[model samples]
Target: MTTASPADELALLTRLRRDLHRIPELDFDLPETLRYVCGELEALCDDVTARYGKDACTVFSPCKSSLCMFFDRKSEHATAVRSDMDALPVTEKSGAEYASCHQGHMHACGHDGHMAMVLGLAHHLAESFDELPRSVLLVFQPAEETTGGARFICESGVFERYGVDRIFGFHLWPDLAMGEVASRPGPLLAATSESTFDFHGKATHIAKAADGADSLEAGMRFVLDAYGYMAEQAKAEPCLLKFGLLQSGQARNVISSHTHIEGSLRTYSDTMTVTAKQHLAELAESRAAEAGCTCTVHFSEGYPPVVNDEALFDLARAALPDLHELPEPLLIGEDFAFYQRHLPGVFLLLGTGTGIPLHADTFDFDERILAAGLETYKKLVRIP
Candidate 1:
């Protein structure tokens, strides 16, 4: 099959992207969105196979709607490209003609564009199957916004089954201009963990403050001490300890007996991540004990820092054109880190021109950049 020109591919991809944008779905519940993606993959198969007389199979996730298109299944070595298939909970304010039709859910992170670019690669691969060097897999992943799907995908042993050599994924960065790409070899994104603390103490009237074990006081001390430790740690390495939720007394006249504190921990260094969790847990316990209160600390098993494999990074730098090496690590967390833990891979940042940041109500990208993304995916697939 002869592939369409760049212009034709972009035009078709624009339409498909809008169709996906109109029906944004949340994590792990993308029934209609899944159907649309599978339909597109199937359509590509029918069109390209009929024209070229080649064979291919597009596999749909049995439980969810994630789609994987395989070309050259018999080859010993395989290459995979991934695009997430989930939307954030942000409401759309972009006011585009193709803005999300679903309320309170939007593809504000540009996953719709990511999916489109990968599909463009799939279409190109289908059309040019004869010249392809090795087997290729296009993974349409689900629940990326919540950091919930990649783990499941890794656990499914899809990579080992196909003997995938190295994989590539990218996120659109509105912070940079169109046509620019930035990435590095290590810690492109941070590891993220959530910590929750609960304090218990005796309740007493405000006038009888001395009689109460003041759980609120204990919680306050814990926060301040934790923050101080975080500050000190930051002096040595990058770290973030954010306490976004805190609940204490119900009335002004009561010495609170119970308090709940929730916060997020992020760091580029794995050693720092482990140390910080230990420090916070110890501080919470000690402070609560001193205040004559009991405390419970729960740290979530969160995403690890996205550490690009060195060998894979060298391959990407040489293979991708006009690549910019990022100077510093981003504190943002990505579950794509989970994929790297299993096999060599590199996560890339494709610039989308300056605009409203990701996860915002007005988040959007320049459509022209979609071609760059498509080209990048195609290049990665061709990596030998």
Candidate 2:
């Protein structure tokens, strides 16, 4: 098959990455991003189709802008590659000329690079479509930064339609040196669940503290109880509880009537997630009762833990041998777990050299590191 050299491919990917970086879009409704991605797919794939999630029930809002591009669709078995299309809410401070033109939104997670590498793979595969043994599906998923678009695409019946046999995905990591890649057989990332606690109490003048229920006190008790619960759970298993926002009354003279606590929970095991969440709910109820207040727990169902298929990891290790085995599982979460749950798949990480971490205002990576990702995708495409 005729294809561009590695250097030329990297050059093309760099240009595309820059163009995408300039027009960063947020979750779900990415009209401009969708247009640009479809344009690229038109030039490379055999058949390009767009899919949408369930409607919003009221008000015609733009649904997820997901695209599925095919190459050699007649093959009985197909392999899928996913690239998330959403950007974070951080403003771009990366002094690069291709910095985000959309103020207050930026591709600080290297998703632009991810899209470019996948697009490059599409181009490379299109050049050799006749010789390819299996079909290929290029998934451009939106809203990875917020609601998971992967689940929506999966439920949309693309997998059944394409007869997908296996899938692969990767994320660029700035923690590792350039050219380094890492993955393990099981539990590469943690199962994550987010929660918000709303503590309610009777509001009254501070001078009459005995007559009023103090929500601020209830909130503090809940926090302490949560930490205690997390610590106890950690004794038996690995778990993390992080509190990001704690808010209470606006006036000091008034006894606080309401308080809100926002935090996230992470664990490597589904069992642990259940236990931790149960304990948290119980703790909130018990503490609220003791503090003479009411507590409501609002939990956001989150992505499952990313567990690599052991057999697929073998293929990955053989196809790309230079990978380093990760010492332990990561606390972060990935929606790629949704795909892994459906079929044998692997989620690999590419090192982009150390610097500002992902999601930071200054997050950016060297364009050359994309070569490692491109090479890996090329190798995976050839797997039988």
Per-residue lDDT over 207-281 for candidate 2, one digit per residue giving the tens place of the 0 to 100 score: 998899899998898898788878888888778898999999979899999999999999888898888888889
- For candidate 2, the per-residue lDDT at 108 reads 92
Question: What's each prediction's TM-score?
Answer: 0.93, 0.90
lDDT of 1 at 99: 94
Count clashing residue pairs in model 2: 0
User: How much is the lDDT of residue 93 in candidate 2?
Assistant: 90
Q: Output the lDDT of residue 211, model 2.
A: 91
In candidate 2, which residue pairs get closer than 3 Å at backbone N, Cα or C atoms, i.e. clash? none
Give all candidates' CA lDDT scores: 0.86, 0.83
Q: What's the alpha carbon RMSD for model 1?
A: 2.1
Please report the TM-score between candidate 2 and the true structure.
Answer: 0.90
Q: In lDDT terms, which candidate is top?
A: 1
Off by over 4 Å in 1: 47-63
